[model samples]
Target: MKIIAGLGNPGKEYEHTRHNMGFDVIDELARRWHVTLWKEDMKAEIGQTLVNGEKVLLVKPLTYMNNSGEAVGAIARYYKVDLDDIYIICDDLDLPPGKTRIRKKGASGGHNGIKSLIAHLGSENFNRFRIGVGHPQDGHTVVEHVLSRPYGEDIQKIEDAKIHTADSIESALKDGVDHAMNVFNPKRKG
Candidate 1:
């Protein structure tokens, strides 16, 4: 079994924010698989399905973005899932909007949600699927930038990226992280 955890803050207020990109991806997955993520467990909303013929657990942390690790860690422990069988999706400020990057494992790159995962799990040996939201323009505060909804062209780009990234995630679960990275990461642009 594999666990796919998408990190984001709870509440409708953050539904379309850049910080909620992860939640959007999770929603996309649930829709694509024709499953409902209304089940709550371990502080997360979950849906179950088969990905590449393997049982897959789709999770959206309900503990907010910063404390996402708590929910994911609990699920992982309860499922007795191996670190290698875990995948995480989140927004990345380092890359421009629309870019999607997949890594087998690495540092948090200054994302509090990712940092929390690294801390609670005590390991970075997992998958990270990052959707770019770009850095704040000029003097804009990081918080404000992430919480603000995208406008005009950026909105379309983010929407496209989300769909592509969701597909890439399915590919990763079907093949392997390396294959998904080779197929999608090379096409990423900042």
Candidate 2:
């Protein structure tokens, strides 16, 4: 994979939201790569770095979560990157907080960012790393919960997941998606 797009909305208001888990992972990756991802082109924040000596583009879409495809598709086209060489990191509500999953390719499972990606890019073949943020609680709507900040213990869990997500991305770069999946995909608690 030559491109890694972390899914999230732009703006400080969305920084700590559960929906921004993808951005958190991207920030962690940027720190690891020693690159700040400050570039303001392609409708996203982009930076170039090497993972395991493999050149990779790290992207944080500024198109907001629902329209993330605009930035990602633009980057892919600009770089002439193959669709198969793109990967995404995103939040997943189906799993428990802190858990993560990796997939070679799949449906969006109702993730608007991913759905937009499939529509814009015309493919679901790109790899994805899903960070589990858990569903809303306390009668909060899904939108309310995802946009709200996590509290207490959930904070640490999400933070840990970011580190692990970076590690998983590195593994995918060095090895392959299957290897990353085996190494990083957490077992469910059910």
Candidate 3:
């Protein structure tokens, strides 16, 4: 089974925050697939479904961002899922808003959630679907920017990225990462 974990802090306070983009994308995916409800697990809010005929466990870790690995590891271990079959969706500040990137394997790039997962799992080789949230303007703290919400045009970009992120995950799960990368990495004009 494939475990798709969307990393973010749980609770209403963190909802709609920039750092919670991962959760946003997964919600979009579940909506598109018509998955009606998310069942609670020990460490995650999960939904079970088939994506392109493959069994998929959609997980939103309730362990918050820094400790996300605990929940992800538990689910993955119980399901006997390999690192390659795991996909993490999270926000990226390096890329401009509305952008999405898929990588088969990579370092955490300093994302706390990804770092914790790597630490617990003891591997950096896993699929990642990164949605761009963009960096703050000059003189702003990174933490403050990521925890804050977007506005105006930025909001539109984030919404678009969320939809595209879901599409990329579906593509990667169905057709493989190479095909998904080719189809999604390039700039697409609206």
The TM-score leader among the candidates is 1
lDDT winner among the candidates? 1
Q: Write the per-residue lDDT of candidate 3 for residues 1-190, one digit (tens) a residue.
A: 8998898888888887889999998898888888877899958999999987889988999999999999998888888899989999999988888788988888889889999999878899988899888888767799888888888799998998888889888888888888899999966689
Candidate 3 has its poorest 10 consecutive residues by lDDT at 137-146
Candidate 3 CA-lDDT value: 0.88
Off by over 4 Å in 3: 187-190
Error of 1 at 73 (Å): 0.5
Give the C-alpha miss distance for residue 152 in model 2, angstroms. Answer: 2.7
Q: State the lDDT at 65 in candidate 2.
A: 97
Candidates in order, TM-scores: namely 0.95, 0.94, 0.94
- The digit string of per-residue lDDT tens for model 2 on 1-190 reads 3999999999989997899988888888888889964789979998888777778998999999999999999888888888768989999999789888888788989999999999888899889888888989889999998999889788889888888888988888888888888878866587
Model 2: pairs clashing at backbone N, Cα or C within 3 Å:
none
Clashes of 1: 0
Each prediction's RMSD over C-alphas, in Å, is: 1.9, 1.7, 2.4
